[model samples]
Target chain A: MTLLAKNITLSYHQYEIINNLDLEINPNEITAIIGPNGCGKSTLLRGLTGLLMPAEGEVTLDGKPLQQWSKKTLAKQIAILPQNPSAPEGLTVKQLVEHGRFAHQGLFSKPTLEDAEVVDWAMQQTSVIDYQARLFNTLSGGERQRAWIALALAQKAKILFLDEPTTFLDIGHQLEVMELLKELNQLHNIGIVMVLHDINQAGNYANRLIAMKQGSIVADGKALEIITSELMKTLFNANTKIINYQHNGHQKSYCIPVGI
Target chain B: MKTRTILRGPKTNKRFYISVFALAITLVLSLFFSQIIGAAKVNITDFYDFFMAPNESAAQKIIGNLRMPRAIIGMFVGAHFAIAGLLLQAVLRNPLADPTIFGVSSGASLAVIASIFLISAIMPTTTFLTSADIPIFYVPFIAFFGALLATFLVFWLSWEDGNVNPKRMALGGVILGSIMTSAVMAIIVGFGQAKAELAIIWMAGSLYGRSYNNLIPLLPWSFICVIATLAIIKPLSVLRFDDDIAQSMGLNVKLWRMVAILISVGFAASAVSVVGPVGFVGLIIPHLAKLLIGGQMFKLIIVSALLGALLIVLGDLIGRSILVPLEVPIGAITSLIGVPIFLIILQKSGWKLK
Candidate 1:
């Protein structure tokens, strides 16, 4: 399965952000979109996931026009977790996750056994099963984020989109979330597309990296091929050094600034 | 095992049913209690005989003409306001959201008072006659329209980029409600003592001397709208999430919010038309229901209506009995009782908006 966007022009009140961009998200891969604050990484994510309609061009998921597909059908095929989502007070982790199964159930019917089983599986996958009883507000930031991930997992969608999933997380929690996304892609073959701020972390974890500068895609390829010093200088407008290393017989690249 | 401790499907269902049954009992008991105990003594035998035999004795007259209609109106109005409040709070995701906050009540107040002043001004001979001479049927119509007017102003003012902010709506509502309230006061002060007393009683959110005429017209709207609230329960639950997340979950957030708002307006306006903008029942009952049912969507939805009806009936009873000659307004009593309970819940929940 593939999600494709072509000639997409996204704007905020006449201010064009993503200008005539084209991209594709292939199935069963962890693709990370990274860019600076105003470079439109988040807007591009929103465009690709059908959160915002483009002023020009179109987006397609699995050979169907994104707008033509019913929202429920699209929901079953794709799940999205927005940045810094807030849940109602007194809502438990279990309750939050159960919301993901909304598209699966009949309009007025309660959750069936299958839905319950899916919620349980999601919790276990995210390792939030132990905290199911706790109110979402009482959980730590990382735990709360995982609970939201569990919610997305419960949707059982083939593709998942997250906007800055680890922005507020601590370093350890960030690594945990990145590893969790990688595991989801590898084990379940879910297409995971995320907007991440940390370029080094994106290069380390994601199989494919798409870097943007001022709403235009600067580089899109495997991490090692795309993380050259020239590309870093071109994209970030900063002089940076790139070093290659070997880990587990695989080559990896990291960006390092030249100055002290 | 996992479901038992957290979801606890069967156990939670059992608890919900038990509370429902308990609430149903209290509802009936309160209705019965409101009937038998009033300021005027009604012989129980006469009440029983009136049911069996058509008689015009003092006890039968008081029971049939006075207490029964008041109690029936209380049950339905209480239910209406509570459910309306619960829906508004849920849709807005703001605990402070309520019908009174939305200008519906005070708008109804202004409308009722304005209608009276207009009629009195038009016919100066009727100015000194109590509300009894002002024609009771018009207040319901005038008040309902007033509520609708208030809601329109609030929504129109709060609309921004095709989205309505609850904070803006709440702030707008409070301001509009206050303006209408102050207008009501101006009208009250413009009139003489007897008319002023009538206007004051109406503004206090009292259901004093309400008849079946008022209750009958509100029934079709309130009862049907209350049922319709259940139909939107699925979308309403989804609405608790932010817009982007709700949309991704296959919900039309804007459409559902509109539908929910319209339904809530219908419920609130109809009830307020009859009951002079009763307050706190809507604000307090949903929280009370949540405390009882633990926010499981179905149980929370159903139990809120039940508890709302129960609270209103009991509040009316307490209002009628407490001061004998001076009947406390049900609205005042609810706020008095509700404020303490609200504070306790706030203290317990730590008053977090999140």
Candidate 2:
């Protein structure tokens, strides 16, 4: 399904955060948005996922305007996991994941077999099946993050959007989450879009990288073409060295911010 | 491969079922014991005779008229307060949220007391207990509007930017409740000495001398709100997650939040209007239920209702029987038991609302 944002402007209480932005999200690629703080990366994600209503333009999924589609139908095509989300105390991983099927089930109807299977599939995919019985509060940060991803996966949405999914995670867990997203995109053809803090992680993992500054896209292209020192200096006012490398027979680039 | 059902929630062992069964039995036993344990010196034979024998004794009259209605009211009020607390906790995403703590009950109490004072003032000759003078049935309805108003006030006070902060909500609720309570007392004092005792007793939340007039107004609210809470269990559970996550999970967070607030306020208002402010049932019963049944919404709601009913009936029974002739208010008993446990829970609780 094609998700398109046409000249959308998002604001909170008349103070605009994203101004007249247009974006087209490919349904089968991993897109990483890299930007500094207060650059509207998260706001744009919310606007595209129907979380934030744009004041100016419209977001459409599969040619239907987001406002016209019922929330459940829109949710069937797109799912979003907000940054640093929390669950209720004593909620177990499985129960938390089962909440993803809310749009699929009737108000009073019990969860069907298909819903249960999908939840299981999601947990298994995230490798959190073993922790299904564990309370969310008791899990390690990485496990909790995976459980949240499982919850999003359980929604069975073709496009998944996450805001800084790797924040508060360790280096290994961060890589684990990035690898999982890449695997989901490659195997399941699920569109993955995330706001990433680490530019190197974004360049290493994402098929397409979108760089932003002051609520506008400054660069949108392949990671190799977009990870130049000039772009880093312009976006973040930081001096950086870019190194080209090869991993698994693929060209990859990682950058390091230099002092002075 | 064994398939897991969401009906059972995340994890259900023998312990959860046993706890629910035990609570249900306790509720039934309390209901029975409440009928015979009051000041009138009645026994099991008296209870059986009241139901079975044709000729009615003085004790049978007491059972039929006084104890029976009181017990029934206690049961419904307990269920109402517990469910109200449960719904409020979920809606606010705060472990400490409840009708009494959040000022919903205080608002209802204010509305009730103000309306009563207005009615009495309009008919200056009419006394407080005169059944013919006052429109008793409209009390719950009036209290509902009052509760809705208070809920709005608290939400408005706690709202920041686009979200609510739990700390601000708790503090705001406390301040609003104190203000409304002082106003209620001022109205009570305005009535002078003759009617003050009855109003005081009612405010203290005694089920003493409550009858069908109180029960009838509360029945529909208790039934409808409980059923409505169950009907929206999915959205209610989803709502406990972060607002953005809840919205993405396909819940219209604002709409469902309003529905939860209304249902919860209905429970608190109906019960408060009928029995004055029965504090702590709405505060502690949901936490007690969570301790027993975990936080799965369906089981938590069901067990909370049962536990609430048990606490109220037992509290009422203890309040009346423990002092023979002099009655301790049910509210007093609940507070005496609740405050200590609440402190302990607070000290040990690890949940956060952000």
Candidate 3:
């Protein structure tokens, strides 16, 4: 029902990056983690997804220890879309998406009719049905991101984790991907957790905001409560003027930088 | 049957079957022609008569003892080299990765030559021996050990931190293979006339008069390696993706990679121990198979083995009959064909060798 991390610590070699961190991921909520560079945002996401093992404490899913669960069973429950995943040359979008069926089949078995239908459904959900015949490398950034998301959807996992889902995209493409995540979260009740660099986009799109300074979470709540000028000054060392603007019948908070 | 049809695309299965049939026919033709047109002529009737009633006639002796064994050995060696190449290329994700390029075959050659040199060096000191009386047996066993050692050395050199970089692996293999081959050459140079000539012929991969005795001990290991490679294909396909993705999909990438490397090394070592390092079969045949067959891992391997068997059998048959008395070594003939096809492949596929 919920993925929870308790008193977890992460390290690379001798340097501990995430120290004594604890958090709970609520079901079906889009949680966006925002932090400056070297803040261990991605590392925390990796730990929650069971991609990286914590040095201390434990990560538990549905009241069971993450380590005790079999890898295949864990994969069926959680799917991770790594940043800029590359495929072999000449792989079409459909084929790349079809690879997500691997954990389900457990072998290079032939695709069943139900599997094919699910693959098609995944593509339809991501709206990349037109690009199914195109090679993955041939698409533009936005199209490729959708194709990758489609691949994640094909896994049919309840929780979807993405690291920097909009790092290299332009403003238009970034919003396209962001809106797709929100759509998936709303329509299918899939839990979406992502590490985003832009604080404003996270404020606009995410249901809950988790701001990290260095390795520990500095603030965790609704976007308006956590993204205040005081929190920005204390955590990010930035002097900003906080402005509340009405957009599309909703009051939104915006941070306008004044000086360093 | 359901799984196969589902796995194959609409056209790939038909092409696969047709290609396999073509390869089988080519194999039979090479066997027939090799047997019929040797120095002394033998016919299909002679084979039939020999099968029906055992005899000691010249044609029967040539077909049963020499030509038949030669053809069968060609098939075995070809399949070994090609499958080894296919496995290595898939694991390393490099077009140039192969047993010969990785120094496994040259290491075997070096070990075989060193053992001979060591024995011959000992002979002159003892009063009962001379350089002319060099023992020929036990070279294959020594070569097999050397090939295994060389394969691991290549793997060990390429490993950095926790990952194996494909480019570094290929480079390490090439450098090690060259050094071993040079050492083999230096050993050949140190010998006197008769021994040196014999060693040179063996090194060039000529099977002038080999028979069933040489193949008996090596075949089982080769068979086992081929089966092991097939068993690991599913994991291998998963591994062809980037490492993180494979791991996220619940695959133990390192474990599968180790299994694959062991399988490839097993294939290369056993083949080189018997048939002196035949050139280009491992490197070129896999690429050819990939070109003829598309990117299905299972079908690509099968086709590579079949085509490799066909190529070597045909090469050996041509070597036997192309020149009247002066027989071209099968290795030399394969190189000639391999180099041109390799050039065409590079031009057509237009893949960066990197």
Best by TM-score: 2
| Location of the lowest summed lDDT over 10 successive residues in candidate 3 chain A | A86-95
The TM-scores of all predictions, comma-separated, are 0.90, 0.95, 0.84
Q: In model 3, where do residues sit more than 4 Å from their true spots?
A: A13-15, A63-65, A90-92, A106-114, A128-143, A167-173, A228-244, A253-260, B1-8, B36-60, B111-144, B190-194, B318-324, B347-354
lDDT of 1 by residue, A1-260 (tens): 77899899998777899999988888788899987779998888888878888889999987887888788888888889999998876577888889999888776797799998999999998999887877778999999889989999998989999999998899999999989988999998888999988878899888999989999999999999998878877776778888899979988888887843
User: Model 2: clashing residue pairs?
Assistant: none
Please, what are the lDDT tens digits per residue for candidate 2 over residues A1-260? Answer: 78899998899889898888889999899999999899999999999998888999999988988989888877888899999987887777888899999889889788899998999999989998876877778999999999999999998999999999999999999999999999999999899999999999998889899999989999999999999999999999999999999999999998999953
lDDT by residue for model 3 (B1-354), tens: 244334435565687788888888878888778788877777778878978987999999988889888888888888988998888877777777778888878878887777767876766432111223343345456777788788778778988746787788888889999999888888878763456765676677766666776667567767788788777766777677777777677667778888887787777777776677888888888888766656667887889999888888889888888896777888888889988988888788787753
The model with the greater TM-score, 1 or 2, is 2
Query: Which CAPRI category fits model 3?
Result: acceptable
Query: Least lDDT summed over 10 consecutive residues: which range in candidate 1 chain B?
Result: B124-133
Model 3: per-residue Cα lDDT over A35-65, one tens digit each: 8888999888888987778899999999897
lDDT of 1 at B14: 80
CAPRI classification of candidate 1 = medium
**By DockQ, who's the top model here?**
2
Instruction: Give residue B97's error in model 2 in angstroms.
Output: 1.3
Worst 10 residues of 2 chain A by lDDT: A128-137
The predicted structure with the larger lDDT, 1 or 3, is 1
Chain A superposition TM-score per model: 0.96, 0.98, 0.97
Q: Is the docking of candidate 2 incorrect, acceptable, medium or high quality?
A: medium
- Please, what is the whole-model Cα lDDT of each candidate in the order they appear? 0.83, 0.87, 0.80
